[model samples]
Target: MKHFHMLLAVLTLIIFVCQALPIWMGKTAKRSAMITGASHLIYTLLMLTGLWLFWQLYQVAGVQHWAIAKLVLLVVAVSATIKALRNQAVQPSQAKAGMMIAAVGYVGILYLAMAKPLLG
Candidate 1:
């Protein structure tokens, strides 16, 4: 399950980069039905697996601060991605900023999940 979660995290990054590259390069973004569907499926599975992992952690060690941080970062990352990609009215600069935020959120999530730090 942990391995699967890691795989999903990598895939999330790959898909985000692939979709955002054109926009980042100041080119028109293109979307295909297949890529859209795959991304949705991947995100759904990722969230489910993540919840399961969190449940396992809770059972073993009670609540952890890092896990809560991961959850918040996950929401931020996904929300920013959606805002950047789906909002047709967003300016190019705004979209770029949103993508950067999503990237940082994802990185933070990955770090928190891997480190599982004992934060107060």
Candidate 2:
């Protein structure tokens, strides 16, 4: 399950990069027939797996502060992804900024999940 979850994350990241790069390059990002559907499926799986893992941990340890932090990071990631999807040629900067924010948010979530640090 862990390996599958990790694989999903990597695949999602690859999709994110693929979608953003063209738009960032000032090119029209025409959606491929499968890209949108694949992205949705991948993200759904990734999120579900993450939630299941968190649920298992919660059953044993209750809700940890870091877990809550991770949830917040998830919101950030979703927001950025939405912005990237909505970006147009008029405001390419916003799209790229959103993509960068999402990259950081996803990396942060991965780190938080692995480290599980407590805040003072």
Measured by TM-score, the strongest candidate is 1
lDDT of each: 0.85, 0.82
Tens digit of lDDT per residue, candidate 1, span 1-120? 999988998998999899788778876567789889989999999999989998998899998889889889988998998888775245888777788899899889878877988996
lDDT of 2 by residue, 26-78 (tens): 77577776998898898889889978888888899888888778778877987
CA deviation > 4 Å runs, candidate 1: 88-90
Candidate 1 weakest lDDT stretch, 10 residues: 85-94
TM-score of each: 0.91, 0.85
Candidate number of the best lDDT: 1
- In lDDT terms, how accurate is model 2? 0.82
What is the C-alpha local distance difference test score of candidate 1?
0.85
- List candidate 2 stretches off by more than 4 Å: none
Which pairs in model 1 have colliding backbones? Answer: none
